[model samples]
Target: MVVASRMLFRFSIVWFVAVVSCFSQDSSQTYEVYVSKNLIGTLIEAKIISKDVNSSKKILYHAFKEIERIDSLLAWQIPTSEISKINSYAGKSPVKISYETYSILERSLTYSESSNGIFDVTIGPLTQLWGFNGDEEPTTVPDKKAIDSCLKLVGYKDLILNSNDTSAFLRRAGMSIDLGGIGKGYAIDRASDVLKRNGLTSFLFNAGGDVLVSGYKAEDQNWTVGIKDPRKEDKLLGSVELTDKSIATSGDYERYFEVDGKRYHHIIDPFTGYPASNSVSVSVIAESAERADALATTVFITQGITGWQGTSDEEFLIVTNDLKNIFSPGFKKKYHFKSIK
Candidate 1:
């Protein structure tokens, strides 16, 4: 209860301040999707290129349903979820998972290894320990002792995967996996694939600004994406041209609280068990939404811009805690900033 109160308090402040800014040309047809019980919302716009409104709407409904199903299967806390079942077997034995679950976990482990454990999916305990698993402010900061205890529950190396058996096991009792970092982006990419398979092109799939663009807009203009200004919610820092790619932005300003003039945000460092400091936001544009989203969080947790080294070859933008900006080599070549002066 104490932890819940803190999370609620912090999120109340964040939502109170969040301002979503978007701009589009006049020729697009707008469609609103309200999937029952899904936490994320999406806005899809396509030109009137398709004459069949009924068919288009049907395609969208199925697409949304597919996303919801993926979320349900992967959610760790949901009692009936596949992940919950795997968690139920944490220390006893390797629990066999669905093919999809196995695939995502395999990919997550690969990413964790690639990032040198910087992008661990097994940081669930630390995430919830700091009052970030849900929406709220913590009643109090956890004691270093308690936090250290939870930190023991982390470590991607402890997760054992059996390829032949298609099973997963966490060596420790309390260790668990959380896909919050990459699940949404994976779902977006999957939905985009589904749409393409259904013969629908030229659509945008976005979940709270983690977006994927598969085809060109109706008028043949590139998909225009606006990056939110981390310092000012009502303003945009820049816009990027997306011919065929995905974009994901992670920022501290979207979820944070200030106490005694010190700020605490939602992005947690696996090594530190606290909100990562220095970088305020990181936006990644990549060939896959999953990679973009994972890298966004990974880059934000890395201090002193050293993390930029791993992404030097990719297209990305970094907004520092003090508002200093760093763009990847390709980002400046493809986009323009609205506010940098």
Candidate 2:
């Protein structure tokens, strides 16, 4: 169920200080340990505050280990990954997979169906067609005819899940699923579990921009995240305080190219086979990073704030194309948003 409300409020924004700066100041009782590495195509960073530095490093080691395991299992570009294997066996037979991969795929399909296929996992063909799936930047826009053909192979319904045997299959020969939209969030959740299991209560695990935080930054200060202005580089719209929750943001500025004065972004509309144009950016705060990540993409494609149906726990913030800020009712109530002018 959608956990946040659909009601939204707009305001002329103002900015505040970046909250992350305070984390660097040393605390007298606890040692703050920070670690970062390149993983899952982006930087994964973590901050652990503990009484012992050795224990903090140990906890981070286990956390990173869990994340690396998830990347190996879900990364589509890795030939040995279960996702790649599923794509390889498309239209032929079901490939048995790990419970973790199967469960994540099942959850991904749920978002796809709930979002009316606007957040499809079977968007691999379209991603590759626009050259957004690879290392090199796309220099030109793809042909409309080519896009139309690729769209035929892009449908979440075509991804068949056999829960009984823990296997998955793509019904069409060319249909493939890319977990890129949701995998990192799932990984962060897994890593968070590792931290908790190690008896670490205060830590923040961030995979790229998807963040899951628990406990407080200091004694009572909640961890704060800056919301980036989608149109302005190096400028933040505001900051929001969070604890024991996850937040993810999706934006056209993340990956895009301009051609003939038109900007083509990575977030594609499955129905139209082009960049979704409803909103410039969408940020979702949910109980799990997985849900926040998928909902961010779903809401971005489904007309931004207007497309969102709220649940008690999930809240969202959207920046319209005109650069106006829209906040979910729960978001406004739950988080103290310090906006920048």
Candidate 3:
């Protein structure tokens, strides 16, 4: 009887441990990662749906490599990239680009044209002149003379693309292309693709606040992602449940310069040559992180009911400068947002 009783006690303890482990697995398991690059800073947290803690390290390494590739391609200061090559072709014939660079630049131009110039990639010179390209201090706004000179060089129409050759070129020498607004989110999408292809059953990857989610939690559990409150970093304005989707946020809060008590953010209006003023922030939800990344900036720069009317097939959820949130009709049903006080 003593032996039998001891056996029963051990069985009970085993069952208890099993139950506790199950509960812990269901809650969420997130791994922290720090990657140093771009002077722009990249922070990401990945939550994979599994109890095996060892897999987290592998995922972190994979993500780090993916982000590094993006940084190299999109970093404006990096003088030996496809972006720089395109910039060099300015004021000359269209410079042929690699297949990869041409694809991204082509998509950028499409978004620019589709949004009616709200998402211009050719605004680099103006962005730099305004000191948004990591400049330490604000210079006076570029005068009408400077802007008009640059405007001649600006214009998506002037961006020459050869579909047959898969190359891109700018019409003027002073013209430059900066992918700052959209590159990270595109990188997040690419990284997520790598994870999924590698058999990562479920994962969430966020570059800064641009987020992409794939698969589900353990055994069919959905993933929940919180949209950061633009006004308060510590607060989450809302939570969205996703099985496969991407979320990207663009806001005046992301990066900016201040002069004369006015804040000039990184999202510049291609038409006005100034930081867009309509919305303080805009968050977009789409089927792919790439589209979400580009549209968030496009929506912010456009800033209105029609900010992204014809940009892409992807849907969106946008928050205005006044804190009033807008959602594409289809996207409205997907999540719950905390009410603003």
| Ordered list by TM-score, greatest first | 2, 1, 3
RMSD of 3: 6.4
* lDDT digits (tens) for residues 75-161 of candidate 1: 886777777777777777888888898899988998888778888999888877877667566646678997898888899999888
**Between the candidate structures 2 and 3, which one is better when assessed by TM-score?**
2
Residue 31 lDDT, candidate 3, scale 0-100: 41
| Candidate 1 residue pairs in clash (backbone atoms < 3 Å) | 6-136, 6-137, 6-138, 7-136, 7-137, 7-138, 8-136, 8-137, 9-137, 10-137
Residue-level lDDT for 241 in candidate 3 = 73
**lDDT score of model 1?**
0.76
- Each model's total of backbone clashes: 10, 13, 6
Better of 1 and 3 by TM-score: 1
Prediction 2 TM-score vs. true:
0.90
- Candidate 1's displacement at residue 18, Å, is 54
Q: Please give the range of 10 consecutive residues that has the lowest summed lDDT in model 2.
A: 7-16
Where in model 1 is the C-alpha error above 4 Å?
1-49, 308-313, 335-341
The lDDT of each candidate is: 0.76, 0.88, 0.73
TM-score: model 1 vs. ground truth = 0.84
Clashes of 1: 10
Per-residue C-alpha lDDT of model 3 across residues 105-218, encoded as one tens digit per residue: 888888887788888888888877777565375646668788667666678887888989887878778888888767877787777777776677677877788888888765
